[model samples]
Target: MQVMKFDMCYICLACFCIYVSGCERSNNRQIAGEVEGERIYLDEVDGMITNSLYEYLFAISETRIIAANELINLKVLKIEAGSRRISVDSLLSMEMRRISMQETKLKYIRDNALQGGVVDERNPFKLHPLDTPAGAEILNNSYQKFLRIRLVDELRVKYRARILLSRPQPPQVDLTNVTSHARGNLKALHSVTIVSDFDCPVCREAYPELSKLFERYSDHVRFEAISLSSSVTPPILFAECAAKQQKFWEVYGYLYGQKGYDFNIDSLIAQFELNREECKSCLESRDQHKIIETDMNRLRQVGIEVTPTVLIDHRVYHGPLTDKAIGRFLDDLFKETPNPGN
Candidate 1:
């Protein structure tokens, strides 16, 4: 797994929300961008444009940084027959700024616990204990109030820098173009939607059952897997690339077909009959990268938090996507209304 230089801002947001609200909530919002870059090539696999993590990072750098320094690397992509250029520092800075804002918000709420009677609107901090008057008396101490105010002020300044730095520059355009090939596939399906990550154990485990389910109901199912790699690589977009080659089902079969399997890039890429050059090129292309970000933004809009999150019959499933569970849910739905689809 490639260790990302930037702190995972999502984790920071989670911590901040938990501290402030005393409730478990997540903050994984998607920011969008428009591309004014050169006309590029994209591989159409399995009726969809292929995307990958490598591509997304590239796109972000292009939009964020005016110039790519020596630290930035440019590599030729085989799939699109294009060069992918990116700045490491710029990407790291973007992620860090995101984390900083979250941390600052958490600190602000903590600081204004109850000093001077001005409390934070989202107070997660506890007031003085009240088992007896002595505990309540301690709350009246001026020293404690002073300490809290000082702490809040200091932390706020630190986090404000982060918020400013990570703030997303305006997106030039929103990338949500579904290729003609992809549209055709959608028309064939009773429903077209994105599934959860490949790295998720549940996703791996659910692979065979999902394949079987899709096969049995091919007349009504159009399934697209969202590649949520625990690693930095964009596994989902790679899967999309395979789909363009009309190999999505085949690749999906090979991937989910194996039980308790661990998939790596080399192993998975080797299995494809795709034009290695084009697949590689598209996987690293700037446009494809932007598309993946758009997809992620769409997923976030629908409030997806975990992998193996499925949208069957327009209903979102966040829990385990098991055979019995799904079957029971589907069966019950059909039972309640014999013609739910209609």
Candidate 2:
């Protein structure tokens, strides 16, 4: 039986170990090439390993990783023997570039390890899709690989040894206190809030799915719709003012269900006589500006750069809503303990 000796360094790095003829120096000397298993076959001084491959190894080291692919004449750097003493940049141009490449790789891996997976052209740094068996398997494998290489003990401690890249849970909505929304006492548990501009076509597309989600989960979720048009009609203002009069959800339905602009605030403003000055003042206040800014910040923080930005719990969903995305959010949310009094 041929027994395989465990070369700890390469095994730890998950590199294929290779044994080559006439190269057995194991102490503190510099060697460079594609390192398979125990093999140290050298490459030309100018041989380049792309930054994508180098950063994975660099992530394990103490230095910051820098991309060497853009640098001129880059090479792979490796530590030889056990001595930390190595030549400075002026002494070995190729060696310096290699060290730089190693540092680059290490930094890249360390940063992404915190994110639970590496971002590459292929994976695109997104939350791994787990809708299918193949996708689920891939996500699981990536998470496992992330945990294996990451050196941060605290992260490993907090993650329960499992890597997850989803947003944190959102607080539960209070269905019983629905009247409070009309009373102008609005508070969101999260620092960032989302105020949807309902007139947006993309928002129109999202409304139904959002409505369904709100119906199922309104007890803990709080989303507000604010119209951006300067013109007001009776139906529009009536619906909004009635909400303050403890009739928000009902008016919301009436206003949104209407097929046309016949429901604009200007059309219903005189009918409701809802103190136009107060309503207009509320809509135009710097406070409203602050609210929109808060929403924008929340979207940006979570990397939602486009509209139809739906803040479901703590997760930010971009583009128009999808049943699949909503399902995923619900699935993830239920996995946690429901909030008290939700």
Candidate 3:
């Protein structure tokens, strides 16, 4: 009978109002209309529905809902395990370590291979091309799959674990009007949209990870970067101007990779061999500033408060980014569709 409550401070009032209206319209549904006098059973345990939880559920998008469900499932499972004298925390820690080890191994192999060229004999980390028969064999191995299956089988046998809740489909987001710097196939089925600010340190750190994703999944996922920064406007303006000359990505890389907050635009112009006059004119004109403002407003409307937020298949993830996290998100999205690259 132990229940978890939702924290309302994280959610906005506007979203709550919308949820309330939706609930009023869905009066015929059992758990949709009101939080009181409603319960959701998980393994014969009653999860009391509270108004805060209901508002939180209705306020957030599908990704957040699925994440919340997962948290609820974990809580229920832990309670169930306690009744059976099982150590759920130990089991979870073990499972996490197993997954982490597999990921580390794969990352090491991939990083070495992608570095390319002469093997640095001194560097034990050096790897061969992934296309090589040896590298290909290792990359194609199903050790991770075997480990996961084994873990799942053991857990199910021991705990009689089952997932009764179904994951809802992620909501679709319209990106037609958003100004973005894009890389990868335009028609790719999976779309990753990043709302980042040039002045944000976290965004700078995320830039490389985002680039890595574009490089790895360009054939399957369309990647777009939208600029939004409240700290500094010049860098974003420079990026937009550079986009006009078909050099957004080039300028973007430099801006993100630069060591300091104060960057030399002239050096970048010279380094990229951009038309100095045109770039300067574009910067001074401030026409592209409106585009950044529009992008900012659009993100705000959708309830995003942080920079370096990534929307992959409409599931929002904030950063500091990691390859494993991005990979897992893509894997989940790919699992639901037959043609992942569609």
Candidate 4:
């Protein structure tokens, strides 16, 4: 929730208006400015900022503000690159190609296996059922991903190549006192803890991937799912009640795989073959609310600010909960140690 100061924002707005006025006066021609004999154009900055804003639905003033900031930053970077005898445009094009290829590969898989006529059963990423609102949701998410990739490509070229920012330090979270509903071996060498909300769509999307990882690496990795909020407390408590009957996974899957958040606990109990009397008693006890509160407090202590934040061995990852990304993270962790079974 950080924001620039009002005066600073006002200055940015003034600069933007001046730049736009310059462009209009020049008959909407490309060149907006020059940096150390190198030409900086309005179109290039527009392209970068426009692509960045594609995924967002902001007000016109807000969009202009963002575009102005991006344009200013890009001009500074271009000047720096010129000083270093480097071509910013060339670097950006190369990075864009790299990002484009990676995105293309992911989309190809999604199209062929998930969205196309034939469903590939072996594909790890689950596709939302067609003819459903969830399907449209997933499609919109994919489009956003493409737009983000474009923004990332431009930013990486500007910052990463020049080492403008240092690598971010991971959050220091103490996991010793945390309790988790877990699968896989407790004594396993590596631990994967997911602090997530059952009500969160992203967390629900990550569920199957984590399940697959647990299944695949049960011997080597301990997998824990800690419920992080009261937002989905009812379903979570229902799952806890099912856990009392040793049917947690079944209930967990049923809840997440359902079309929407409106859950019927009694119906779920019958569907999952849980003992009705015991589950009803457990639900009525209200003890699971305390458990959820404890988890949320623990997350807050560790500066967790998002749903579906993951801690794989001690490294934290936030959002973009794709199977491939998680797999790569796990692979990096695995590479640092001897075989877990050893």
Candidate closest to the true structure, highest TM-score: 3
Candidate 4 per-residue C-alpha lDDT over 1-342 given as tens digits, one digit per residue, 9 for 90 to 100: 134554465466557656755775775578768989999888666644431232221223334445555665576557656776879866555554666666674574475464542222355365566457766556555555564456554655766432221112243467666667778778877777887777888888877777676776777777777767745378777877778788877777777666675587767777888878888888888576676567678776765657777776655654246666567555655666745454
Q: Score each candidate by Cα lDDT.
A: 0.46, 0.42, 0.63, 0.63
TM-score of each: 0.40, 0.35, 0.56, 0.50
lDDT for each residue of candidate 2 in 1-342, tens digit (9 for 90 to 100): 111222343254444212211233344433664455554434322122322222333332211112222121122111211133554333244433444454453464465463343233375655543455645566555554443233223223433443133342222222221112321113433211233443556656666776676556555545554333323433434445555545556666555655555645654545555666766665556654454445445444334344454444434433236655565445545555444454
Clash totals in order:
28, 41, 0, 0
> Would you give me the overall lDDT of model 4?
0.63
After TM-score superposition, the amount by which residue 294's alpha carbon in candidate 3 deviates from its true location, in angstroms, is: 3.2
Instruction: Estimate candidate 2's alpha-carbon lDDT, on a 0 to 1 scale.
Output: 0.42
Off by over 4 Å in 2: 1-195, 220-255, 270-273, 280-305, 318-320
Q: Which rank order by TM-score, best down to worst?
A: 3, 4, 1, 2
The RMSD of every model to the true structure, in order and in angstroms, is 24.8, 23.9, 13.0, 17.5
On lDDT, the stronger of 2 and 4 is 4
State residue 333's C-alpha deviation in candidate 4, in Å: 1.6
Q: Which stretches of candidate 3 lie over 4 Å from their true place?
A: 1-171, 318-320, 338-342
Q: Which clashing pairs does model 4 show?
A: none
